[model samples]
Target: MSKSAVPVNLTDRLSQFSELWSQKKVAVLNDYEVKLAKLKGEFVWHTHEDTDELFLVISGRLTIQLRDADVVLEPGELFVVPRGVEHCPVAHEETAILLFEPEGTLNTGDAGGPMTKVAETLR
Candidate 1:
């Protein structure tokens, strides 16, 4: 669903989840999708060879652990991990994030594993 006809209140959607490392699709726009995820602890190291991944911290904090450095983000901050760059996302505590990526972009990227999900709509 597109938010063009209605406002998507992220805070409301986020309240419905408590699972860590799971992404829930909220809306779709053209070829991209807007998703929300609840995270805690550390995520697997992965990379999307075909598409850059966008991460927007909605609440709490997150750190994108790249091979060379760690990129930390606070609420309202956003970052795009370039395609093909190996990276891991770790959350010290419960964190909420919003992601904008191509429709079929894998959550685990090219490093698909058990954590990899067939991204689905939550509502």
Candidate 2:
């Protein structure tokens, strides 16, 4: 990717990013990739077999909806959805979110639920 293709600051990039559910990749590890996203409304219920997903709320409020439980996150708050567990997401107010998960982790989880986005890399 070109110099222009990279974001000067991932935090700064949050404002112009999509308010809907989507992943804008930032960095990576041997088995994981980090992404930043803006979330609002409800997402689909889904799960991942081999990878657990981490969620950190940078700003605003976010809610993780699971089959048996739900977690509400305020700014600076975080939660994890374990591997093979099903969960959905919802945000009453627009929220900035960060995630760390395996490289090929499916956004909609294993079944390709409705919240899935065609993930993208920053550089």
Candidate 3:
């Protein structure tokens, strides 16, 4: 089997955009999508009832606030929020993160407010 020649540079792709809370698609694996997002402040409380959401911090810090406790992650760390669990992500400073989830997973999940965004492919 032959391997694909191109490699994705996370930093280079991240530099293409500057919008906070918006996800940019970098690649897809089977039915899932690999996305990069810049985050700051607090996101709306939401729950993905069908699939788990993975968050990998590429830079700065992040706090995944749950109903009972908060899970903090620094650079190079990751966390997965299980399905049906309510979660809110907070970042005091500008944070860069990679998200792995099923294709078409909404950024706002069930919240569906103004902050919701469609993950546009990074070209």
How well is each residue in 1-123 modelled by candidate 2, as lDDT tens digits? 986466547676675566478898877767788888887787787778888899999989998988888899999999998898888889998888899998877788766755667668864
* lDDT (tens digit, per residue) of candidate 1 on 1-123: 654777888998998887778889999989999999988989899988988889999999999999999999999999999999999999998999999999988899878889988666866
Listed in order, each prediction's TM-score against the native is 0.93, 0.85, 0.96
Runs of candidate 1 with Cα error greater than 4 angstroms are: 1-4
Over 4 Å off in model 3, which ranges? 1-3
The candidate with the higher TM-score, 1 or 3, is: 3
Per-candidate count of clashing residue pairs (backbone under 3 Å): 0, 0, 0
lDDT (tens digit, per residue) of candidate 3 on 10-120 = 999999999999999999999999999999999999999999999999999999999999999999999999999999999999999999999999999999989999999
Q: Rank the candidates by TM-score, best first.
A: 3, 1, 2
- Would you give me the overall lDDT of model 1? 0.91
Residue 44 accuracy (lDDT) in model 1: 93
lDDT minimum window of 10 residues, candidate 1: 1-10
Give the distance in Å from residue 68's predicted Cα in candidate 3 to where it truly belongs: 0.6
Model 3 global lDDT (CA atoms, 0 to 1): 0.97
Give RMSD to native, each candidate. 2.0, 3.2, 1.7
Candidate 2 — which pairs collide? none
